[model samples]
Target: MKKLRFSAFLAALMLTTLTACSTTDSGRRTVGQYVDDAAITAGVKAAIVNEPTLKVSEIQVETYEGVVQLSGFVSSAANIATASTVARSVNGVKSVKNDIRLK
Candidate 1:
């Protein structure tokens, strides 16, 4: 019973810590802007994934104030261009920074 109580306490503490961290003020991002950036990142990733020609796992998406940045490696120049195009197609993406390296 004591061990189970400790385990429950640990789980609650971890959950509190995670929730606090998620809401912490970060960089220059207000909490609302942070949420917007997260949405933009998700949107770009979805666009890239929906594109049949690109491998979504090889790309990383980040957004700040509607600007989407794409990083990571792709097998060809075509993939880089495709990623940029897909990112641009996402509704919330203001601009796309394609930094994908050719493998």
Candidate 2:
């Protein structure tokens, strides 16, 4: 019984350590920072979806250290601009990098 318990504890410890040292596409970020960035990305996507003129499904949002990047294809220049503006307006966004292309 004791050996089984020790093995379980050791496994948990290794998992925690691996998660703490994990690197994301934009490089290393603490777990808190990663969660924050995820929130920012979700917020941007929600804002885009709420815009009547924008196609939310066509826009991809990514956030790294508060910097939002908007990608994917849209209908026009206006849509690209709107996506950038919407991403920028989201709270915790440091800046927006719009790479949306016309479809």
Candidate 3:
């Protein structure tokens, strides 16, 4: 019985810690939002990799609140346009900010 009580207390403490960490005074993201952004970033990267005209290694992807920001150097103007289109096609992307430049 004592061991069970200690275990319950530990669980409650951990839960409180996680909840507290999720709240911020600055405009920072919560834990769940961070996870969502990571998923969006991954989806954008995967989409870029699948595009035959775009080189996956040449692009960098980041996401915040469903907005994806893509930046890097590509071979041509068409590749830049293609990357933007591909990022926009992803499921969780609200909008895309394409900063890709021609190499």
TM value for model 1: 0.73
Q: Look at candidate 3 and give me any clashing residue pairs.
A: none
Best by lDDT: 3
* Consecutive 10-residue window with the lowest summed lDDT within model 2: 23-32
TM-score of 2: 0.74
Residue range 16-72, candidate 2, lDDT tens digits: 998977776567787778989999999999999899999888988888899998889
TM-score of each: 0.73, 0.74, 0.81
- Where model 2 places Cα greater than 4 Å from the true spot, the runs are 1-27
Name the lDDT of candidate 1.
0.87
**Tens-digit lDDT track of model 1 for 7-55:** 9999999998766556435446566678888988988888887899999
Using lDDT as the measure, what is the rank order of every candidate, best first?
3, 2, 1
Give the per-residue lDDT digits (tens) of candidate 3, residues 1-103: 9999999999999998888568442658787778888999999999988999998999999998999999999989999999999999999899999899989
Candidate 1 Cα deviation (angstroms), residue 36: 0.7
Residue 38 CA displacement from its true place in model 1, Å: 0.4
Q: Candidate 2 or 3, higher TM-score?
A: 3
Model 3 quality (TM-score): 0.81
Cα lDDT, model 2, residue 37: 97
Q: Please report the candidate that would top TM-score against the real structure.
A: 3
